[model samples]
Target chain A: MNYPNGQKKQINQQNKSVKTNNNIFSNRGMSLEEDINTTNTYYLETDIAIIHKKPTPVQIVKVNYPRRSAAMITEGYFKQASTTDYNGLYRHRYIDFEAKETKNKTLFPLANIHDHQIRHMEKIVKHGGISFIIIRFAAYDETYFIPAEKLFPHWHDKLNGGRKSISYEKIKEEGHIIPFHYQARVNYIKIIDRLYFH
Target chain B: MNYPNGQKKQINQQNKSVKTNNNIFSNRGMSLEEDINTTNTYYLETDIAIIHKKPTPVQIVKVNYPRRSAAMITEGYFKQASTTDYNGLYRHRYIDFEAKETKNKTLFPLANIHDHQIRHMEKIVKHGGISFIIIRFAAYDETYFIPAEKLFPHWHDKLNGGRKSISYEKIKEEGHIIPFHYQARVNYIKIIDRLYFH
Candidate 1:
């Protein structure tokens, strides 16, 4: 409930929408990004870890400065990010990851990720950082944490004219289910603890 | 010279300005941010590190989506960053730092850095991540890598109504001068090697 300025507005909007829809289980209606952001905030407040969702990239073309008000961007376009969505320090380890949720129950499409992002994740892993992807099957209400190393083979296969998506069965076999908590909604760090720390 | 899209445009603008000013020492003309970015690109290309400068944060207030056109931000405001400007993996460690340049030769003023950034750096150090500030004395043509630990005392002093700035002589004694090079222009990793890896 103690979200920061910009995030507070977003949570309030979501709450309003949930009320309008009369959704009894409002917690389950949160998007993956919102859940992760809340989880990161909880980790930051408790001094457990420091992770953040990088701001959406924007290419500003024009701005106007009023007499006293803050400079306003009058013209800008969204830019495709060259790196993953989230990254920060966790348990003295450099952590980086991308989160994607799909309505399709059968597969997670590779088109959701860019080639540069795949290469970035590759470099992160090679440099001894913890890298992964959080895949949410919205239809099943399940989120999986798949390590970067586990993902590379599938990405390579796609590049070599193989299946362009990872099957749900394959993901379930290779990935760890991220537990949902009241505070740390998408508790991916718990998976990291089991995989790397312990 | 292999700068990315937005950065290439900026470098071109800087080059044009330098030419107009007839500043012969063009290498020294680059801003602290540009130098660090170039150095980071070099490190990434050479597979030495995976550090990156986070994109400038912006808060979007309005957007226009014309048919068959990319969505444009019609109204936006710059947002204060919650963390340091630069952060990523370096030598299997979490690297986070802020870069600042001052024209004053006598001392580096404390006002250039925000209080929250100081707190963020403090937390980074506590979590065993590598945290520091890259300070450029534009008047002296020197860039120094001041460890977060070394900076805490001065920041605390400012909080306690002590000197509002750290003098140039004190910085010379406590901070390591980041060597300038053709590829790794700022060459901050050299200082990290000497201080941490050695």
Candidate 2:
């Protein structure tokens, strides 16, 4: 289904995997967000990469202080992020990218991204910063890293009144399939080493 | 005076500079926060450095959408930041720092920093990141870049039940004074160069 503004809503789209009833999933071991976070922590610990997930910005109103030291955030709403979730220095270069997961088995909808974020990513690329989007096809159990440069053409085409999103088949052909490893969970830098550094 | 918990109020006394109007005596020129942000932007534009101020973490409790496309934050409270404001890459080294301004002429009080933040700074330094604090004495229009190594000893002394803060005099003697420039504004990288690079 398309949003009235022709964009797909995903930012706060509660993952069905995170079952509200008891917080148990179909034994995928860990949620996509949790695994990526763990991988980032591991990267930081090993001095491999210094990426960090920016905390979800929340608009907090109405706090209750029952005790002097205890403050409860009684009311708050999540704010839209101005930039991607992850960024940091890697191998002396600025690394910035966003992580996304989709359950679609066919075409990976381009509707997943907001226009402003695409523009922001473009700015990072223009300034010689390494930029990309990490896409995980949950149904296929595969993840791909699509370089910003490659994604830019498609983004431009949309601006020229073309299709606004990339297809899953196109991503499979152009994007680097991130290898899964026990240690470097996402192992995105391997793609970086070949694409940007090499 | 001692607080109800028998913990000496120490430096927790009311900021004597708060005027009868409940407004702190802000500097006549741009605030330190603004100055640092300007300097970071300049650095980014010139490719001299790639530092950025982390967005102030706010918990939004309420927002009034008086008109479409306009979000007016009606109620919110600021949250403590988990990382330093300024962090990015410089000449293949990870740079991380926090900037604070004080009106106090006698001493640059340590009460301004939380213990957890000090611990975080220490971790950054331990991991080989160039970490420091930019302290602007707004009243005198003087700013100093104090290395994390120097600040650590004083921070620990308080934990050992010694002095609770570092004096302005000590900072004047030990910290590198940052020179101002038309373009660089804060020119803190000059201090960083002399202290770390050179």
User: TM-score of the A chain in candidate 2?
Assistant: 0.82
- Model number 2 iRMSD: 5.4
lDDT of each: 0.90, 0.74
State which candidate has the highest lDDT.
1
Of candidate 2 chain A, the 10-residue stretch with the lowest lDDT total is: A18-27
Number of colliding residue pairs in each model: 0, 9
For residues A8-70, write the lDDT of model 2, one tens digit per residue.
Answer: 344226565234411231214555677678778888778777777776666565667676654
List the candidate 1 regions with Cα displacement exceeding 4 Å. A1-27, B1-26
For B1-198, candidate 2 gives per-residue lDDT tens digits of 123574334324545523321232223367888778878889877777666666667766666666555465555666788777777666656788888899898788888888867876776776667889999887777889999999999989988888887888899998988887665668899988888888
Q: Candidate 2, A163: how far from true, in Å? A: 2.1
What is the Cα-based TM-score of model 1?
0.88
Give the Cα RMSD of candidate 1: 9.0
